[model samples]
Target: MRTLIPTLLFFVLASHCHGQVERDKALHFLGGNLFGLAGAGIAKQASDGNRIWTFVGSVAGSTLIGLAKETVDAGQRENGWDNDDLAATVLGGVTIGVTIDLFSKKDDKRRLRGRYSKLDLKKKKQFLQPTSEFVVLEGKLPSLNTLGLSNQQFVVE
Candidate 1:
């Protein structure tokens, strides 16, 4: 619930959003989103969870790809370079980068770590101790008398 605000704000504040919802622009946005997400993941791994590097990587990757795409389009006769498309792409990248940054709080990590530590201790204690009341009987079935049901009747087909 708390994370939804930034996402909604990003869509509202995206650049060059002049009520022109073309398929080409949508595709550019999607492509930028994929590239940005990939970049953020790679950067997070390379930087060992550095927040700034992850955001930079996402924006940089999307911008680079958007530029390359526009350059290619400029070379073609039918599809010329469109600034709006590039803006959409960059916006997608920024959206993802900001989302990652917001979610990756150090305090959240610390809280999770503390919770997991307690859980780990409990798990270790459970594994190290054994209950004497429970017994394992492999390949053998308990008779009615052993089960404390001596008066029970059984029918076999």
Candidate 2:
């Protein structure tokens, strides 16, 4: 019974939060992008209004979800119940949830890093492109952040 309670708790949480990957991804993206946008939004608000509270909310939600899943996983391990699919499914769901949320928000301004980066595109250019038009490439990471990006634009018009 030592492990059973935690297992059940995890199950309940997961069941209630099933198919959350989009939401999780959305939240992840939203939280990451907030730093850029908050400067314009919260700058004029009262002292109590800042980006910190939204950030805290995102952290608590994501952490609680991970902790619940991990706790059940640990309990299951004690019984030798190896279920990789369940673990993977939960993670996938959370990721999808975050992704959905991230893209759902409207942002007039988005940061485009490294002009030569293939993924970087003008907002209008991206809108006209179909989803399947992307060209994936394998690349090695540069050794250091100090390196300057090539001036030629790699992204297709």
User: Candidate 2's residue-wise lDDT over 1-157, tens digit each?
Assistant: 9999999999999887767645544443444344323322222122122334333433444444444545675778464333343344334434433443354343343321112123322234524655654333466544333246553544457
Model 1 ranges with Cα > 4 A deviation:
1-20, 105-157
Model 1 residue 68 distance off true place after TM-score fit, in angstroms: 1.2
Q: Can you give the lDDT of residue 107 in candidate 1?
A: 52
RMSD of each: 10.8, 20.5
| Top candidate by TM-score | 1
Q: Which 10 successive residues of model 2 have the least lDDT summed?
A: 111-120
